[model samples]
Target chain A: MTTTIPATTTAAAVPVGAGLSMFDPVFIGIDEFGQPVYLDVVYHNLLAAGEPGGGKSGLVNNICGHGVLCDNTRLVLFDAKLVELGPWRDLADAFVGPDIDYGIDTLRRLLVVATNRYTWLLANRRRKLGPDDGMTVILTVIDELAMYSTVLGSKAQQEEFSTLLRGLVSLGRACGMPVVAATQRPSWDIIPASLRDLFGYRAAFRCTSLNSSNIILGQGWAEQGYTASDIAPTNQGAAYLLAEGGMPRRIKAAYLTDTDIYNIADYAAWTRTPTRTTGLPDMGLAA
Target chain B: MSKSSPRRRFGGKSTGTVTVIEARVHRSSARNAKVAFVLTAIIVGGLAAVVATSYLHPIVALLLGGLIGVTTGAFVWLLVRVWPVIRLLWWWSTEILLAVVLLTGWVQLANHTSTLVTLVVVAVLVGVPAGIPKLRRLVIAWSWCLIVRHRLRVCFAQFIIASQSGSLPLILWATPTPVGERVWVYLRPGLSAKDLEGRLDKIAVTCHASTVLIERASEGNAAYVRFDIKRREVLNARVNSPLVDVIDPSAPASASPLTVPTALDLPDVEVPTVTLPTQAKPAGKKSAPTTTANGSKPAASSADADDDVSDWI
Candidate 1:
């Protein structure tokens, strides 16, 4: 069943800003009232899920594109369906895709980096990584995560991926690493409850059923007037975003065309050279 | 005029006047009795002083007797004034002394044992109980409840003093909540909730709280104030943060595979010489510089040692 409310008149547009502090707010989209919504990536791991053609990829691209342009942000892209993330391939510090093994290797590499970063932070008497410390923000974007999991050869491989991903999702926020995973189907097998619980922020587009919406946004969310199933299928970029423990609000992600992606990639390339000279590799983006 | 006629003339006056004269006579008789008692006391005291100094030289005895008399009199007067407080202190000191003795004996026993053995024993005794999650939570919750109660009491006392009111706001309860702790206080009939609202920040400061919220009670004319108590940030519990002792080479590896170092452990990779920003130092270290700067030799040596250790690390 679909339910639609009349959109409010105040549509404040949120523009993407340059710079890589997780504390800096990025424009996610406009709310029901048309006022632009913003969310800071610090201390939050995000999960976005919807049916095919629900504009999930567009939202991910908008967020990732903005993040890639920031001077301090490093992007790690794991695209099981390589076509969606192909435009920004040149911009990402590390792009693994089209094959499941590469994605697994990327996850393993991220786990190692996270572990070492944690150790380095502790040795320096830092509790968590922040933008003020001149540290780089590692933003990992995993698209078609369900497909990536299915491509694993064995259950052990799947479990290993789950364990490492869980560690990154659960523990990565404070170390300036945040994982944003998106999938078309948020089924029990695709995104297990253990994995879903770790994501503090959730965005749901038009989903196949209420159950899918609940799985993505949490239980009782649908009852709480945040029913993603109510969103019309044709509303491409419209979604319900729950962030920073606030109430879920309907928002449309800022659209990023191919040209926009190219421009963001150019900015990332320009910023990469100087950032790498600081002895910290801009490991998340590719040249 | 005849005597009987004079008496009749006096009786003609009001009965109140006759009663006033009788009261004055009764008061004078009481004063006379007090004076008589004081005189007897002085004589008895003089006799005691004489007995005390009887064996000394005659002149010395007189001088010593006078001294003794004055000392005894002053002590008796002071005892009479503050006997209640002395009694209370006497009872408490005895109990406290007993407790201290027992505690000291236990500490001595523990000290006599090897440090390792003592630590192991302590860990077994306290750690076992603390290891149980339910028990640990219960202990934490109970302690939190006590702490909140004490904080609320302190805030209430300060409020009363600042308000300068004869009546006090009745505190129903101070209970913990998910965000912080909440206290229910009933405002007296003459008092306004606004009086407490204005002082919420001062109360929070006194209580060492992060923030305070004052809201009207759901049912009554009381105010329910919530205190967001400040707590020390535990770095190790933070996500993606390393454990407190994780960098120590002697620490054992965690059994969890998630924490086991995988590919990043390169032997030749040098740990960066990252100097932590010293915007804020621990409270203990703030005094170290001043002490060293004063040119105390020991403090200077210790400061040098600290610098050496940091350099080595």
Candidate 2:
């Protein structure tokens, strides 16, 4: 039986203004049993990796869709290919394309914002952010993670970007800023165990081999019968998702067609327009 | 000299020496001190009575002082006796309230109503909450949490190490989760989270759980362990995006200015345009075998059989 849940939160508790809250769980897709699967996006940073044409984009887009439709939510998107996350460009705070320096600059700025938030949190004696704080949730998504980490302009710049990204992933989670990065190449140089472990939630799409699957998910998962390589190539959206402190479970990422994307983006753009007054601040990079 | 010593004898010739036993009344310093304190209080009271002799009769003054001294000692004893019980009550106030409510409620129901009626009422009380899906899940999950607490205690007793007191890890608190229950426990001195990790299967079996994942609950304390007991999986199903219903259809189309088409309505086309070439046949080539208007290929003409392209198609 297909159960249709209307919204993430109950009718009474849904955020008052135009959309949902980042504190609310975002519906990404269904798990293996056809049950609805939602991620606590604010608390969890997701790392999705698989072969080209796999469903990494599908999962990333789901996060982006939910992010754009949220109230008091800021999105910073990096799409090296430019088309995967391009639909929501008009609504994002900063949408970087094909430029390593620009991507590094965005990461550096995001780290600054994260540090500032930590300072605020320290002053208030809070370990993490809460819904009542009224602070914006910054959702930074990198569609092609390998592009900036390995294939970008210069080795020094790429290393700087990786280092800054690692800093953000570590610092942003508690500050209500989470990173959802996707890459086609799941290699050690791109995502070492140190970097991979920083992500609390990881989705391993169909990999060409078990080792690549282990790179996305932690080590020894492939041996434990949770290998993404076992997934058929035809099953594009199927993946083994490992949330922190749990075994990897198979799930199919929810797909948003181009028209759906365009509709959502247009609506988001209308909602975030400056002329319309709302609780959110003027849209830009965080202070 | 041996006879005078009267200490030892040959083993087979004489019986074993019997020692004289004596009783000694050794005074306990605490008892003596208590007695001294009481006596001092009495002496002070007696002095106060002597001081009061100028105002009251000696007999009345003496009685009053004795009464005052006894009352002070009695009050101190009563406090010493009741403090432990009061502390215990304060520690388990909630548990005591629950037990009291259940016992009194059952008694009242049984006294006022028939046995069958009482049973029915009790059933309804439990049924109403259990009938609600969310409440039912919470109740079950928390019930599992309680079960897991005892199961862990059992596991620690049987499978894991215990502290010097032979006491199990203290279950600090528990909460219900979507999949199961999360239990936080404070490990005793002899036990560590690593020790429990090795016996997860045993603990899972005792808790009637499919799986039990143990992790350090607090970064500051290694003894604090969190157990996530999974009896079922929450992520087995394909969840449809809430965005699928984000746009309401019942509302006027004007609210959503851009209409999203749900299904494609393809126009019907003539099959001849697709199957046969649109361009006119070459003038010099043999006339192609004709197809019927229904798009069914007709039998090839005997003369044009070799050049029929439709046969290959």
Candidate 3:
């Protein structure tokens, strides 16, 4: 039987308020009622997981497009699957993909930025990063995270990646650098428990199985009627989002076609300004 | 032996080892004498001043001299004993001054604005953004950081007092982590992380946190105690485990695999034939023959015959 859940206001229906800063509520997607569902990513990193063809990329694109459009936000794209993110190459502050070693290097570079930002924040005695701060908000997008992890040839390389990503995940929020990673598989083998636990905001589209759905969300979530497994294959962009302290809300991500992506990329590229990049010399190898 | 004896005889001069020792002793005695002389001179000078001031009463002069001498001596001893502590306090004077100024300002502001207005202002400032969960967490985390920065020493003092440990734990620093805030505290001599763990709940309660975790600090006699300032519910939500089984049995089973039976059983009984209805044909149309030229009833009822037969056929 199809479970009947109480309908929620969707993202599109929610009236956009005046004087809302970029650091304020971030628009995620539309809820069941077609009202816009806005979430604050200021202090919470996001994780999006779903089966292949389940609109994970669409949801990520929606969020990333919003982020890129924000005045003081910068995008870092790590596209392990090269096809999905190739169109937005010009928009991103740093784009890494198509090669495992290059992806690792990009991550290392971002790690350095995270560390430096942390030190700067600590020195300035500021906890939250806002438009008031001279630096821009950094939003790192890692597409096909499972593939990225798998490409790490050695255990040590994986561990290093995990540690750096952990630092960014754990401490990046305070520095205004939040990571939003999408994965086809939400298994512990793909996304380690340590890294998985750091994601405070989780969204799951149509998952392959109940196990995958639960892994993306949390234990007893499926039981609580927040089952992503029940999402029909035809409803590709539909997902269940669990904010930091909020209940699961079923929302349908606004679909962005190839043309829409090109437009966003064009806009972002036109408006983009060069920001400071980490000057640390490359580590030469994946290790 | 004979050569050594001859050399000894030739060298009439003494070794002078005893004279050198005597000279060292004399030098030490002279230094002591100089210190004693300086002390005596100061005392004599003070006494002389007292005597000069108390020309009218001899008894009063003696009493004043004794009191002054004792007071001076005690003051010097105390200063020598706690010079390091005094230096540290002096170095921290700016922080203390800032704290006092802030407290004074707050008190004045509270008096002027009244409690209600102050609360309203604070609520508007902190509570508005706190409506967002992430912002709420950020605020809580930042407040924790403030606590660690300013009031951690006071909290540690209270913990020490409550524990009746008779000594203070040397606090290095308290830093906020992803899970919670980590406090580096040097356990006093003869203490361990276990000792702190025993009183951690009390500390956590005082700090308005859910719990405390004590681990050995990376380097030194310090222990890292993480104060989980976030509500227990929030922490649980952040790091929850995945559901193992489906809760709603009546819900649609989308995750179930599609299955197909490999074999089927058929009955042995023969069936009776039914008459087919004839359709109207146009005057000029002719009907096609159903039987094949070489067929023995077209191998009727065979699996291949059924495969070839369409609904139209």
Leading candidate by lDDT: 2
Query: In terms of TM-score, which candidate is stronger, 1 or 3?
Result: 1
lDDT of 1 by residue, A1-287 (tens): 22333321211332333434556776666664446677777678888898888878877886786675566777888775656775556556677654444556788888888889899999999989877788778899888887555543334555667778898998899898998889876667886778878998889988878788888888866643456786767677778898863667667776666555555544444444444322222222111
- The best candidate in terms of DockQ: 2
**Docking quality tier of candidate 2?**
incorrect
Winning model by TM-score: 2
> Mind giving the per-residue lDDT tens digits that candidate 2 earns over B214-236?
77788799989888776775543
lDDT: the better of candidates 1 and 2: 2
Give each model a TM-score: 0.44, 0.48, 0.43
- Model 3 C-alpha lDDT per residue in residues A1-287, reported as the tens digit of each score: 12332322212222111223448676655664446677777668889999888888877776676675566677778775555875665556677654455656777777788889878877988766666886877888888887556543334555566677887888788787889899887677887888998999999988877778899898866654467886778777778899843667667766677656655544444434243232222212111
* RMSD to the hidden true structure, all candidates: 31.7, 19.1, 24.9
lDDT per residue, candidate 3, B1-313, as tens digits? Answer: 1232334466665443322122333454445445554565469647755776657476666666666666665555455444434644653555678699878877887889979998887677667887888888777776576565334455555554423323445555555555456666655665565555566556667666654545554444354433333223211111111110112112211111112222222332222321111111222323333565675455444423232232225
Model 3: residues with Cα > 4 Å off, grouped in runs: A1-22, A273-287, B1-313
lDDT for each candidate structure? 0.61, 0.71, 0.60
Candidate 1 residue-wise lDDT, B204-245, digit = tens: 676666445455555443444333343321111101111111
> Which regions of candidate 1 fall more than 4 Å away from where they truly are?
A1-20, A271-287, B1-313
